[model samples]
Target: MNKKGWWLMLLIAICGIQTVRAQGETPTDAKATPETLSLYKNLLKLQHEGMMFGHQDDLAYGIGWVYEEGRSDVKDACGDYPAVYGWELGHLELGDAYSLDSVHFDKIQGWIKTVYERGGVNTISWHLRNPLTGETSWDTSSKEVVRSILPGGEKHALFLTYLDRLADFLNQLKAEDGSFIPVLFRPFHEHTGSWFWWGKDLCTVDEYKALWRFIVDYLQKEKSIHHVLYTYSTDRFETEAEYFERYPGDDVVDILAFDLYDRGAGYSEALKYCASVVTAEAKKRSKIAAVSETGGPIAQNTEWWTKTVLPSLRPYDLSYVLVWRNPWQPASHGAFAPYKNSPDSEDFVRFYNDRKTLFQKEVSKLKLYE
Candidate 1:
């Protein structure tokens, strides 16, 4: 009885492990909560249906509005909230009451819980100030910036303090039922460009990779934050090699994403090419793929959404495509999405009605965290 029983148990255990591996059910966070695991699987499944639409700072403020409850430019124009909601954590590292964009941390927290309870997705990106110079994230004044914040670097301790603040915010994103609200935590995004301190030219590839790994390790392991999924994103890239050049590794990245704004006539081709490459790579790795950030002023082309954005992304198996914000200041370049009665509003509505795009009404039916 002892010999046969033990051998059968061992064989069954091995088979179960193999089954999970074959199905690609393991998240990058080994200890990811059950709801987090469910969310990941649902995102992977949603890729086949359509890409979810996302808007940055959608509920915090919008064109001609500030902190108005239940207000969103996207909703005003299209009559639906975006399926994915994007938030920024730039000033949280400095213990600021408001984000760099001036949205209060408490408001952001409440909005995140609202989105989660409604079964929508939440993704947050950090634009923390450069640790070396205490300047904006765009301050690439020092090449040693990335190195300075790494494990043994001079500012490593300070970086941990920053991470601690971020962890505190994330750990508090809880629902009324006491379960953590899972979110896509995208840190150090757009690293392919030189504008940011951690950009490609600012840090060696190995250093960049190390930086990414250290963040994931510290947040998930040391800080005990298991409700987050790490996203690896680049600003723009022409080839798969460029996209993965500084990738942290499969074990630490749950999503493969990129951000591309309209740059001119080449935008469409570039979008199609990058989407194809990213989705294909994601398929190969069993990871989620997305256009994490995109959209530019559409004044020059009223049909931009339907003709350019939709067409280029319609063919890819991407989880979501997010446009930037519609700031209250009319002239700010931050207005990437159309506002109510804007020239491109009609086109945006068309883009939303398309079968290939998923907005709040559609995504709410997916039960992503169940």
Candidate 2:
């Protein structure tokens, strides 16, 4: 409250910034490419200030912000948006695209550019369908799918065509001022655990690494899609060795991140343990870290916003923590950002107001884009 106290706080902040800058490994603020230099550097600076809060489908939809249909829960509740917006490239990979989401491609591109120009961060995850079986990402029945999409396989060309489609889509993300919209493009996430076709048991370590390298190289080198920062993420890991077991090497990855969906594995304790692993590894690698995806039943636990979630992140200065989307169905309990009059709405307001948590309101003044 006093001038002396403010000076001390300022000194501590400067020292924090200097300590992280001095302990450099590669001086990457989490950039997958040179195009993301501004974003990378700003995230590094933010590591000294406060952690960012992200929301999956916050723009496309929320409890109120439905795709092509409704309003925004975040805007209505907190009078601002999320610092980071999470989206999916799944339907776009499928060609027709509209089969899954009411949100159209044109709309998505517009929103992405808006967020980028507004100084908000955008992180995209892919749930690409099984190229071999024409099935969804969750269908792992075909053991041969991973091999089919690799460089030497039969479906390899088809997969490249898919990449071309994705490239075309990403290239459209330009701000009104004509600058490319830099995005945190996360692909093949949660590979450390075996759930998807690209997971641990489905592909060998070398095969996974090769896949990642090829994807990043193809998109950048061949397609000229340079408005992206590649993020390498995995499911929860217990040890440092386990975390990097399938890493695609430091050359390709920008942000070292992971997903931790606490489905009854001791809740906050499990989250804290995994958070330590991600943040430490990011610092060691000189990359920014994030809780790429996480959420549980917040409706039942009212104080979840301020108590459980924020406390789990107190030990780490992560770039952002993106909770899962808030589906519009009446029976859903998985909404991460609270809607107006929802059970956790008031608690979420407290989370938004917390000095340690960075939201869109706070980000408006941070000048992250510059």
Candidate 3:
């Protein structure tokens, strides 16, 4: 579709209140690229969006640390609702195998394998420090480990080193055919904002583009990491073109996504902005979009979040709308935590319960696993 065609279709999609009505028929029988088909298959599963709950370790990895290990809390929280069960892997840790020896490595591998076996979607996001300024080292291990085992470089070299090390680990973890267990891998996320060292505000677009292309090229050609789907995610950009401008193109990305958080401030507006941006991008690129990560302080936006934000995300090609953390707090509003005080443990429960039917219907329509 041309840009004009995409805009017209987007206008109709937004103005039209009947979201249940599917958009005009496209050529379903025509062969779609693996990325295209995978996105569509996942979108169909999105009717079950509530199945995926979001967790962030930087704020509260405690819950995620337990849940990923098969603790009862994950099941207890999501028992009634089928979910994607999302978690983020650290950037440097991507190079560090969770286990060193073969037996221990297998255990870590087994955890990941089981999650995929259960249709769990894992997104590994990493933090890259600029090695030029004498930055960049592994967080989990000693400097020697990063120096001896990890790849290092200056400028774009730092970013490429992380990617190269990760690609190697992914190779070891994959099946003999090189197909990864189906998990969503999102690298270089939140680029529109500057909180991270790699964010656009910190680095020039040309530099970001170079780093992005290098990672994608090395993965697809040199490493032949075909099973891994690369997603380009940004924070809520200030303008439409701001969002579109950062899109690296379909060649480098399989899924398009964003992460947003609210502390009861502009809850409705944030969702509206996201809905507009995601729908436009999805149509333009012929790709799937997701509110890959979001949630409010369980205390702050309990009512609005469960009612407004969660339900509103259903209309678009939103496959995974996840809750940030299990607990609540005032200070939690930053990234993962919405606040410091726990007001409602049941906030998530309410969201899960309220949206259960919608999720079930979406999942049933998509037949996600197949």
Candidate 4:
């Protein structure tokens, strides 16, 4: 929809989500497994606080620690970490694979456990490659991957095997006490964007919904993997309808979120609109909401941390706002988060110190996971 249409819808969404006798703040029992009850409670508690921050590869690895494991972007900058940690399951579904930078598929499991042990939250996304042709995720050269991954198709069995490997990896995320580590696992993300193989143009609504439900079922019910909170996310969606266009169902989704970025000069408009939609939807459904991904060249925009970024989030009760990784040698132009001695370092320190934003020390002290 156009920008004007989106704003009009946002007004209605705000009314429905924040008022008009919607369900209470408590989620209406999303059928959580015993393993995930406490985790869901923690998410609800966080929603009330609306104070959590996350960084991708914060503890597992970063640009300077390409060869080393157990490092963090936040730690390098300010001797602390974020409350939530974001990781990717790319290339790991198929063993012996390499990342986009050709790094071997290793260390992610250890990192998940590390974050869990530290009483931090773990959220994972998958840039899964095409199961049909073994091409990259954005290689939309063919439209058969989603179809074939469904039941009774050419690659269906292979997809199951891939999932089997994925389940194995997830099952291995454990604390030192042998308890399963809970994670917010988001799959087939950015469906609103057409760059990925699973984009809106490539599949019918039924096809996409089926694929999401099937994966959730196989992993949770069939694989007996209950330590996961399945999340539904999109990128830069404007309206409520656009947000739910490809949503599988509430039964299969635990968290409702969206990713926004400073793609151009000012993204504050889109960020506020998307956050309103996401927050309203999550509240209407009694689920948690988060800014799954967002960042910009903080180093270039010295005031980005407090001025442009945090101000846009002053509206609602969001669980977390996770920025992209801080690249030591960015193939792109800029760093998503500030690093030590970076141009935006002082602003970032102030942003972290602000009581509104929760860092690892604040969240860890809560022992939300325990």
TM-score: which candidate is best?
Answer: 1
lDDT of 2 by residue, 223-243 (tens): 887668778888888888888
lDDT of 3 by residue, 1-370 (tens): 6433443453354344343434421113133335334534555434333334444332222332332344433234434323444444443433554422111334445555554444445455555444444444223222222223223432444545656776665665553444455555777777787666566655566556666676777776776665565677888766777775666666666667887766456766777777668756766765566777666554444555466765666555565666554432234233333222224435545665553323322233333334
Go through the candidates in order and give each one's C-alpha lDDT.
Answer: 0.88, 0.77, 0.51, 0.77
lDDT for model 4: 0.77
Candidate 4 root-mean-square deviation in Å: 7.8
Among all windows of 10 consecutive residues in model 1, the one with the lowest summed lDDT is 13-22
Instruction: Summarize candidate 1's per-residue lDDT along 127-210 as a digit string, tens digits.
Output: 999999999998988999999999789999999999999999999999998999999989899998999999999999999999
Error of 4 at 278 (Å): 0.9
Q: How high a TM-score does candidate 1 get?
A: 0.93
lDDT of 4 by residue, 167-248 (tens): 9888887778777888899899999988898988877788899999999888877888878888899988767889898999
How does model 1 fare in lDDT?
0.88
Q: Which residue pairs of candidate 2 clash? A: 61-65, 64-71, 65-71
Best by lDDT: 1
Candidate 1: list runs displaced more than 4 Å.
Answer: 1-22
Give the candidates in order of lDDT, highest first. 1, 2, 4, 3
Better of 2 and 3 by TM-score: 2
- Shift of residue 38 alpha carbon in model 3, Å: 4.5
Cα TM-score per model: 0.93, 0.90, 0.69, 0.88
